[model samples]
Target chain A: MFNKIYAFIKRDVTIATSYKLSFFLRFFGMFFSILVFYFIDKLFGSTATPYLMDYGGDYFSFVLIGIAFTSFLWAGLKSFSKVIRRGQMMGTLEAMLITPTRISTIILFSSIWSFIATSVTALLYLAIGGLFFGVDLGSANILSTAIVLVLTIIAFSSFGILSASFIMIYKEGDPINWLFSSSSTLLGGVFFPIEVMPDWLQSISKILPITYSLDAMRLAILKGYAPAALTHDILPLIGFSAIVMPLAIVSFYLAVNKAKMNGSLTHY
Target chain B: MVNTVEYSIETKGLVKSYPQPRNFFEFFRGTEKKPVTALDHVDLKIKKGEFFGVLGPNGAGKTTLTKILCTLVLPSEGEVRVNGYDVVKNGGGVRTSIGLVSSDERSFYWKISGRENLVFFAVLNNHSWSRAKERAAEVLEIVGLESAADRRFETYSSGMKQKMAFAKGLLNDPQTLFLDEPTRSLDPNAAKEIRHFLSSLSKQGKTIFLTTHNLAEAEQLCKRVAVLHRGRVQGVGSKRDLGRMLTRGERLMLVVSGLEKPGISRLETLSVVDSVGVEGLGGGRVRLTLELAEGSVSTVLSEALKLGLQIHSTRTEEASLEQIFEKLTTEEV
Candidate 1:
């Protein structure tokens, strides 16, 4: 099964490497997203700058981490769904589905492929965003931040798989995928603190795993907090992982089994 | 020609169904409709090293049965065994044991080279990278695509791509090969080359199960053939056995010199001839065709002699597989 996973990842990487224009677009897109969001923050009367100063960090640094994490994680999850959906559209879905390996393994392999791509973009984001914005690049808890990022990826990607199940079942009508990609970015505190929202929306956003991921990321990068300082956020992220990962995986399993039972596993 | 080896693939009462749309709404909501029988009680046993051909019109359940045996699709009802393992219970083993070649050229990544596609599938089949590369090279050589191996698959012509697909199927050196219309859209020369390659594969002790709509190709390559229609096996046996099933025997065609169109009745008056058909007449000659009952040629000749018809030339022709197929598929018996 490791061999299968390895082959699956290798296949995606080979195909990804072949698309030079798309690779460049991914890099440019990551850069453009940060620039766009920074200007948007400026237009808000630099309301966020004084907030970051009060927290003893540059406002640009605060939002840079946010931009990096959200874009990177979003790209990782989207990569799996986009590539797999492309395979389905091209009628190779049956080929992938019929393989003896578990469907989760295939999804995992593809998500990891995208995760690597996202990580490269994140590194470039740090380099260019730091140089241009003159933000003090925080590294007080870099290792712990990296670990949380990894766990957050695994957690969020599992939910992405669940979203994929929704896609498989509904076929084509509305753009549920767009709803997934953008909704999470907007609601999960990628650009601002959910505390700034109304109480009801804040309560709803707190339940989202990305809310905790963003909180922990801000604490680690801007607040000079160690892993121990992240206990309030870390515990919930772990809880979200425990609850959502299995739910997502089981949902995917159920989706595939349903497809098989209905003879729709290969249906376009 | 089949070798003297044993049977490798055997199916008993294999049946499969796909959901069929009964109405427009059901058509829009596909897979919610009534089940359409794709394979209805198909029983086939293929001997090892045999070049078996499955001939059928479209919607004849050829691909359905192949997909079932390869474990790509589940059989709604039936028992199938490939190399002694049940397809449903031991699907992983079955998948690893058999190779499949579908007619679709888009199955592989178009952006990757032929070698990359082979290695990817080989690795997925649990081979090491080195072993996968080695196997890819070997099969590429076998399919005569060594020169084009480095080029991306999208650049390949249909024939070259087809050959690469064949090479992919052989990556595992599978004991049984399921080829679904393997040479469907190729030029005649390219198709002939593929047929020759298939013959070589059969000689290597590979059990080949092929489906084709080309009757002449089947006649040239298959030792035993099965005809499918309307989700059922219409006929299944050696060509000789199928030919013998036809009641009409020993069709004879005569190109007589100095004969005219009016000779149709005189030819029909022959004692043993069941029916005489005048195809055409040209240059003071007639093209006469006769369908005779078994062992009736002698009586037909005597009757023709008695009629005092000039017999410039005569010859007896056995029924071709095409004729036998046409008779069986169209007629009741």
Candidate 2:
């Protein structure tokens, strides 16, 4: 299993880096976005906002973690379907499935490179912020942060797999992805605190895994909260994972069988 | 292998259909349209070491059959087994025992080297990394792509990419290999190279199920061929045997000398002779073309001898594969 995952990752890395200009452009764009966010935070100055008081009241640090981890949300919710769509367009889906490798294994491993690349981008965001934007990570709690990130990925990946199920059959126009992505950006505390929203919208935000994920992440990283103290966010993320993962797996399984029957497994 | 079963590939009553679109009125009335049947009741059995070709025109369900046997598509009806594993119940087992060579060259990553592609596919087939590297090189050499193996796939010619596909198929050393239109769009020389490589693989005693529209390729490589038309198997037999079926009406050409008008009639009266055409030669010798019903050439000869004709030479003209394919696929068939 590890061998197969490594092989796919190597293949993607080779292909991804083959586009030399696009590769460099991505990094440049990452820095550009970071700088844009830094300036906006500068306009706010050192003025403390009540919404961010729970996490050192630094809006730049709070929003930095939020926007950086949004990439993870996109990776989890979009990578599987993007991989499938790319495979279909590139005409590699049949070739890949024709191997003895199981379909489930392919789906599970197809997004590893996306997640890994997203992690690097996320880390780069934190590094740039800490070095130049006056954002401090001296109080970071590594272990608690790692646990929340894992659970967050699992919870987010459930939605990703479900979106992939729709992509597998429909070929395009995945509804699940748009619903989660737009909602997560607007209400899941990515660019702003959920507390800043009205009471009704905050209730809606409470149901989203991203809201808990971002909250726990900010508390752990900025406030240096211990694992024992992070249970308030940890339990809900685990519950979401426990409930959604099986549903996603079963949905994907059904979608694959339908594709095989429809003879559209390779059809685009 | 093949569960000790003699046949490497087998199918019974196989059927596949694609759903059809309905009109607005039909949709409103809930009238379901009949699906387009791609394969209708195809029954086939291929021996473990035979090179079998499924001959068909475009849209003839040859690829559908290949996909079903490869466990890539599910049959709407019927049972399919490859290497003795039921395709539906044990697709993984079937997949493990078979390989595929698809004509779709876009299947490979354009940015990677041919060797890199093969090694990755080999890994997918459960080969250890070291073993995959070894097998990748071995198959690349077998396909004569060693020199070009390091070049990116997009830079390779059409022929080279097809050969890389072949190398990938051979990575697992499968018991049964499916080649779907293996030489679809190659230049004549490039196609001949692929055909020659296919001949070598056939000699290695692997069961090769080839789907092709090229009658010459099938005739040259396959021992037995199945002609599929309209999602149905029109006929399945050795190429020579299929040719014999085509020749049933006009079986042989007998050139003779010293045969007269009376003798031609007498020879025609024989029960085995379906019809006889006599063309006069200048020196009172005539060439007789005999179409036989159910008798040996010797019987025709003896009967012609009784008619006081001199036999010069007899030639049994076999129908070309093209002619047989045309006969099988035509609507009249």
Candidate 3:
């Protein structure tokens, strides 16, 4: 299993490095987006949003954490389906499916490199925020932040595997991608606090695992909340992972069987 | 109790059907679709260490059968077992016991070198990193790609890409190998080289199930073959047995000069000749093809010489594998 994970990471990194320009361009793009948000935060000054006071009272810090954590969430949520789709297009999916490894192992291993790359990007976001934008994280509870990040990744990966199941069966035009992308970005508090939304929308946001993940992460990273103090957010994220992971796994198995029966396993 | 099965592959009444959309607007109308049967009912047994060929034209379910045995696709009905493990219930066992080399060329990571691709697949099959690299190197050498192993796959020619694919299949040293048109896009020399490699592998006690449109290659490489036509097995046996099945009598071709009407009439009158065809060669030469009953070639020739026909050349012709395949498949269609 460890060998397989290393092989997948090596393969992806080799391919990524082959396109040197694209490799550098991705980081450049992320940095430019951060600069845009930093300038916007400068224009808004420090006393604008009162909701930010609960976290760090700095708009740039609030939005930087939000952007960085949501980028991590996006990577975890889309990596499985993206890998499946790319495998189908490249005609390697059937080859991978015929191996002795379990389907769940293949799916999980395929996404680990993406998660690691996203983690590095998230750290870069934090470094830029601290150095150039005056964002502070000196008092953050590191252990609590790590726990929230791990839980959030597990929870979002479950959703990603479910989305990949749809791609495996449908082959094209998977509605799961659009549904999750729109709903999660709009209500998961990536750009702003869900508390600012209408009452009914806030109720909807409460149901999303990403909403709780962002909330817990901000509390841990910005306000230095301990694990015991953030049980309200951590419990739901854990529950979501525990329940959704198995369900998504079962759904992925069924989708693979369906594709096999229909002789569409390799069809793109 | 353990089951002891002699055959490497066994399929009884295996059937596979795929659902087809009713029409272009079926999705909008939500209409019920129909199923198209890819394999009607295939029953086969391939012995251990035997080189078996599945000969068929396009759309003959050869690929479907291969896929089912490789455990990449499921049979809609009946049972399939590879290495004595049920394909549906114990797919992992089947996968571990076999490897597949498909005709599809896009199955590799084009950006990576051939060695990396093989190593990656080897690790996926549960090999350690060191073992995977070792196995990849060995297989690349076996497939005559050792020098080109480090070249990116997209830079390789079609035949080189195919050899790389073949090397990947051999990475695990599987007991049974499923090759679907392994030489489809190769030049004649390259195709011959691959065939020789497969023949050597068969000599090493590897069971090979090869599907090919090239009848001569199958005839040269396989000990037993099954002819598939329209998702059905039309015939299965050695080349001689299939030929005899299609043509129960022997065929003899006679080239003669100074053939006359009386000579033809006399040859037709011979009791051993079942049928005779005469084509004029326009230079006082004629070609006579005589279908004779068993053990009648000598009698026919003697009778022809006594009738004043000067025979320049007499040759016996058995139906080639291509002829047998065409006859069997076309007759069924």
Number of clashes in every candidate structure?
A: 0, 0, 0
User: Of 1 and 2, which scores higher on lDDT?
Assistant: 2
Backbone clashes, candidate 3: 0
Q: Write the per-residue lDDT of candidate 1 for residues B60-176, one digit (tens) a residue.
A: 788777777877567787788887778877878787778878778877889888998888877766688789899999999999899999999999999998898788788788888
Candidate 3: lDDT over CA atoms? 0.87
Interface RMSD of each: 2.5, 0.8, 1.0
Q: Candidate 3 docking category? A: medium
Per-residue lDDT for A29-49 in model 3, tens only? Answer: 878988888888789846547
Q: lDDT winner between 1 and 3, please give it.
A: 3
For candidate 1, give fnat to 2 decimals.
Answer: 0.29
Q: Give the candidate order by descending DockQ.
A: 3, 2, 1
lDDT of 2 by residue, A117-167 (tens): 999999988998899888999999999889999999999999999999999
Winning candidate number (lDDT): 2
The fraction of correct interface contacts reproduced by each prediction comes to 0.29, 0.86, 0.87
Least accurate 10 contiguous residues by lDDT in model 3 chain B = B1-10
**Shift in Å, residue B44, candidate 2:** 0.7
